[model samples]
Target: MAKNVNPTRMALSRLKKQLATAVRGHKLLKDKQDELVRRFIELVRKNAALRKEVEEKLTTAFSSFALASATLNESYIEELMTLPSNDMTVEVIEKNIMSVIVPVMNFDYEEDFMAQPFNYGYLNSNIELDDAFDNLATILPLMLELAEVEKTCQLLAEEIEKTRRRVNALEYMTIPELETTIVAIRNKLEENERSNITRLIKVKKMTQ
Candidate 1:
């Protein structure tokens, strides 16, 4: 690439301009990559915490539900779970972080007919069933939060990789090639100037 550039003042000027732009672009991309890395790390940490919390809660909720199921008639438990008293809608919205669009989930619940377990009756329901329902409902938002964080982390990580690649291309390849072409042009111009001066001196001596 450097060898193909014409070694002249005009070429030197053009090469210098390209080099400056490349350097500036490299700096900006490098900064972006750094910021993305920072954000990705933070999101990863948050995701880990949320995942752990959600896992623990899910285990507890399921275990409690299982325990309650063991004592209750299978047909009755299935009937109770089949009809949900609450309506839920999940709305997804996009949020920008470091120019990356990540999703934020919001759950909108309709009017609650019954906010507690055994909404039909407490006669046959155990305390474990109540505890299970409470835990499950409480973990809903946490699970959504975990999903958001995880997706954000994934997107940030991808952007970081792309930015790093571009930065490397400018810093290592494009900028260096331009600078080398500039140097070659300047050297060629200087050599021509000396040759002209020497030729003029010889012509003067011959004229004298």
Candidate 2:
């Protein structure tokens, strides 16, 4: 159906301009959506890998901790672990990916997290306790990375959906309506010109 527009040359000019703008915007939005999907897929793959690795390390860490608990007194183990070992600072920043601002995380520690996290006597400490602590420290960065990737995936998914909606509106609705209106107006103008020419010829014949 033609758009609700006046069938005049001025209105046609304006609608044609609008159609041009809408077509350009549609192309740009479609391109952005494609790139966002590409980036989202990449992040999804990375998220899967990191999730697997983190889960594996977490399982290992829990197993070692459990073994250490069995060997050590529960109260003593809790007391030892309750003391803070490393000073950690987490910095959050945003990076723009296809106009979607996603989070970037940085973990800074004052001391080596991979080092022995306990300040207790070596003779009293179980090997399993040290192994568990090491594994936990090792996976800290991976956990943060997984968080970032997951959040990025969510944000990209939302932006891609939004862009797709806009592209569809322009491609299917707005552009088509404008084109129809332009055609209807052009046909009206041509019909009016023909009528005017025919009337002039009739008058000339009558005068002759």
Candidate 3:
């Protein structure tokens, strides 16, 4: 929208003062846009790195489980058949980072899956392999967390776009409109002053 502010000779000082304020506002908004873009890109790179590590570890965990299953006695494994498979627990708590608090998930394992003779407990050698599996499972929630961070970056980018549009409109349209109006008013005032001076000189000569 074009600004319709009228500035007279007496009001030039006020218009200049307000223009200074508007210029400062434009600079501040520009700075904000630059900072948001910088941070958003940084988060994207971090997300890529984290995903790579999680995938590699997850692949290793899966292969370990396959090896364990093959090494154990298939027929003799009936004793631990009742043990849980998808038996994991997690808790998400909030923690702050640069004024934004994100969720952190904690993993818990269900122990005592099988209780029997001393030699009939879980596969002891494979317990570390299972622990590896659990650790990778823990990374699942963090992946979901990275998903959330990525979403936040997208939203912030959108807001920055809208703000930039408004700033451009003001700098290119509104300020120019005000300046044109002020210049027109000053020219009219000077023309009127010259007309009055000519009239006063002619009247004085006629009286003489």
Candidate 4:
């Protein structure tokens, strides 16, 4: 890299500037990577907890559903499942974390659904079916939250990878190349100065 560069003051100055910029950029990118990792770890932990809770709730709900299905008439249960109990609307918004844009989901649902979720008549449906529907209703928000956190972790991980590459390039390649080129140029310039001084001294002695 140093051999390719012109060993002149102008080249030296340019390389010095580039080295400074690379150093500064490396520092900034390193800081960003650190923060991204921190945020990613935090989201990962939250995602794990949310996933566990959602899975537990889903297991309980499915167990109740399985019991209901076994005890009740198959056609009756199928007909009841076909009916829509409530409506849910999800509004996705962007949130910035260390320059990474992640999704923030806002859920809008019928408030009445939480209060009275079951649509079928009590005479036809058993207690297990009611419990299943109730558990599903309770887990809805948690499921949405889990989705949001998982997505955020993905985005952060991608950003972190990109930042790490940039930091490594500046730290291990660009900055070092520029500094080496600058030193080579300075050494060449000093060598030329000494040769010029020797020539001037010989000329003065000849004139004398």
Candidate 5:
């Protein structure tokens, strides 16, 4: 369907100016969108590598923690083992992603490592293993957060691309079509005026 446009010489001039502005806007948006998409993809790859590292570390830590329990006196440790001292809070602030406003996540973690319940007098064990688990636990949230932001960035990039395409269409297709229509109408109007003037001149000549 044709865009809702009124064909007029003045209107065509206005549209031509608007098209120029639209083209400039499209270029800026496309550049921003391309940069954001590239950054988002790079982040995603890094997140994947970090995630795998975290998973492997946690798996090993958990297994060792399990073994420590199996070999040691479980009952004594159960009563004395308090939870690890770990605290984290994520704050999200505003930033622009391809002109879309989105959250930039900030992570905060307090530092305090808790020792194990009782030192195994003879069967050697690592208390820091517990600390390792707590550390990784804190990092898990951050990894997940990075993943979320990465996905959101991808979505914003797609939206920016879509908007740019619309702007291009208006600049290159719709407005041009309207301008052509306006020109045709204006020329026809001038031709009719010229023909009327000629007819009036002939009538005066005949009467005289």
Candidate 6:
């Protein structure tokens, strides 16, 4: 259906220009959507792999802790848990991916603290407990990386949806409406020109 625009040369010119712009915009947006989807899929795959690794490591860590708990004295375990350990800090920064802003995280820990041995006595602490702590520490960076990737996928997904909507609007609605309106105006102008020619011929015949 044609848009409700005036059937005049000026309106037709304006509509043609609008149609051209809409077509260009649609192509650009479609390209953007494709790239965003590609990046999103890659991130999703990475997220899946990282999640699997993190879960498996966590399971190992938990199993070790459970074994240690079963073999060790509850009071002593409680005392060991109460002791303060190393301090870690996370710094959050933003990065742009296809105009979408996502978070990047950096972790900082004290080098001296990490270099030192466990505070607990060797006789009281079992190997299982040590393994559990080591596993948890090793996966800390992976856990942080997993978080960053998941958030990036989320942001890209949102942008893709928005771009898809715009592309659809231009492809299905705006461009079609302008084309229909321009065709209608051109037909009307031609009809008026034919009528004028006919009237002039009749006037000449009568005068002759």
Evaluate residue 161 in candidate 1 and report its C-alpha lDDT on the 0 to 100 scale. Answer: 84
Better of 1 and 5 by lDDT: 1
**How are the candidates ranked when ordered by lDDT, highest leading?**
2, 4, 6, 1, 3, 5
Cα error, residue 161 of model 6, in Å, equals 1.3
Residue lDDT tens for model 6, 1-208: 3646777789878888998999999999999999999999999999999999999999999999999999998898788768767778899999988899999999887775444424677777889988887787778889999999999988898899999999998989888888888888899999999999999999999999
Q: Any runs in candidate 1 off by more than 4 Å, and if so which? A: 1-3, 111-114
What TM-score would candidate 4 get against the native?
A: 0.96
RMSD of 4: 1.2
Give Cα-based local distance difference scores for all models.
0.83, 0.89, 0.64, 0.89, 0.63, 0.87
lDDT of 4 at 3: 62
Worst 10 residues of 3 by lDDT: 112-121
Q: What's the TM-score of every candidate structure?
A: 0.93, 0.96, 0.61, 0.96, 0.61, 0.92
**lDDT for each residue of candidate 3 in 1-208, tens digit (9 for 90 to 100):** 1255443556766666766777788788777767767776887788788778778767776777567667766554444445545455767676553333455656554453222211334544466445544565566666666766666566666766877797897789767765766677667667778888999999999999
Any runs in candidate 5 off by more than 4 Å, and if so which? 1-7, 72-87, 114-158, 161-176, 179-208
Question: What tens-digit string does per-residue lDDT give for candidate 1 at 70-159?
Answer: 998889878888977777779999998878899999977744522653366777788888888888888888988898888888888888
Cα deviation of 206, candidate 4, in Å: 1.2
Off by over 4 Å in 3: 1-7, 58-121, 124-132
Candidate 2: misplaced stretches above 4 Å?
A: 1-4
lDDT of 2: 0.89
Off by over 4 Å in 4: 1-4
